[model samples]
Target: MLENWHDVNGLIGNSLIYFDRNDQQWHQSWIDTNGSSLALAGGFIGGVLTLSGTKPNTGELHEIQWRPLKLGRVEQIWRMSLDNGATWTPRFRGIYYAVDQQN
Candidate 1:
């Protein structure tokens, strides 16, 4: 999957999600206009797609989850743990809806 968007401050961001059959896991790479980037790897857990990893430069642990909702919508949550996963703080949360193609 591919995604591109800009925040209210006009910070362009892009991400790619793919499945690596060799490891049987899903991976995602994200980068933003601020030159920040992140890489995470994991698979579905309890029906939710959760991926997590640490930032190579900052060592900050990050996790992102995508949950399915009704009417083909989805909820995405991004979290961060500065204390080695001992405590988590929500960084971003957004709901996504499928675009109507027949428009």
Candidate 2:
């Protein structure tokens, strides 16, 4: 589970991720304070965990990727496509590190 802070418009998001052994895939269920929700599923691809799915009732394709970096850091990128993936727009990009490394 994860939560967001200091988000614009006071929108807070919560997500749950898990790996399903039956299909050997990772799945994620995310919901926000604004009533938005998403369900994505995928597994490691080229060393990055990539998950993608379309938004409910919106037809917007959303993809998120997490890449591990050096020094116990990780990068997360979220993108969306409105035209069935013909084009993509970045929605969020963040780097996360351990608390002890926050210097």
Candidate 3:
């Protein structure tokens, strides 16, 4: 399920993103304006869910990304790398409350 898309000048648009259960991987092309569906990263098991990828337009890279332990949890982790994935800087790490559960 495609949640959203980054509409940049129409030419450089990318899908917000979603995890592909069948493939067990994410595609860079789905979110890249280039329309080149390439495997961004493979999912693995280590107690916690994980994902990684680089934004096509920004050329930013990330790895060992963590996800929520369960589907309804409010907390999540986010990281990013500016130097072509040489290093990942922790930008945001906190719990997110559901302001509108109905939505």
Candidate 4:
């Protein structure tokens, strides 16, 4: 299920606003679906980035660039440019999930 973006923002913001008035801990994480580290926050994973890309071939056999993000659904693109961005390929192109750790 998708996390409630508003709730996530609200609760986090509320805690921050009353930090000195409450006994709470603050931390962040950069977590991948397969449980890999992207970044560390307060000694744990807080956030992560997922990327993807697509390349269509033309008559010249060169690849076309990727598409941009739309309103509802979007893919994270990790395009491979071993040849420096002329003709390209996909490196990581799939659905990714991020896990947040709280104290």
Per-candidate RMSD, Å: 1.3, 2.1, 5.5, 16.7
Worst 10 residues of 3 by lDDT: 1-10
Question: lDDT by residue for model 3 over 6-87, one digit each (tens)?
Answer: 4435654443345677877754334455564322565646645456677656777655444554555545465778897677
- TM-score for each prediction? 0.90, 0.89, 0.46, 0.24
- Sorted by TM-score (best first), the order is 1, 2, 3, 4
Ranking by lDDT: 1, 2, 3, 4
Better of 2 and 4 by lDDT: 2
Better candidate number, 1 or 2, judged by lDDT:
1
Count of clashing residue pairs in every prediction = 0, 0, 1, 12
Off by over 4 Å in 2: 4-6, 101-103
lDDT of 4 by residue, 1-103 (tens): 1221123233321111111224342222223343332211121122323222222231222221223344433344444554545766664454434445772
Error of 2 at 14 (Å): 0.9
Q: Please, what is the whole-model Cα lDDT of each candidate in the order they appear?
A: 0.94, 0.92, 0.56, 0.31
Question: In model 2, what is the error at residue 80, expressed in angstroms?
Answer: 0.3
Candidate 1 residue pairs in backbone clash: none
Q: Which is superior by TM-score, 2 or 4? A: 2
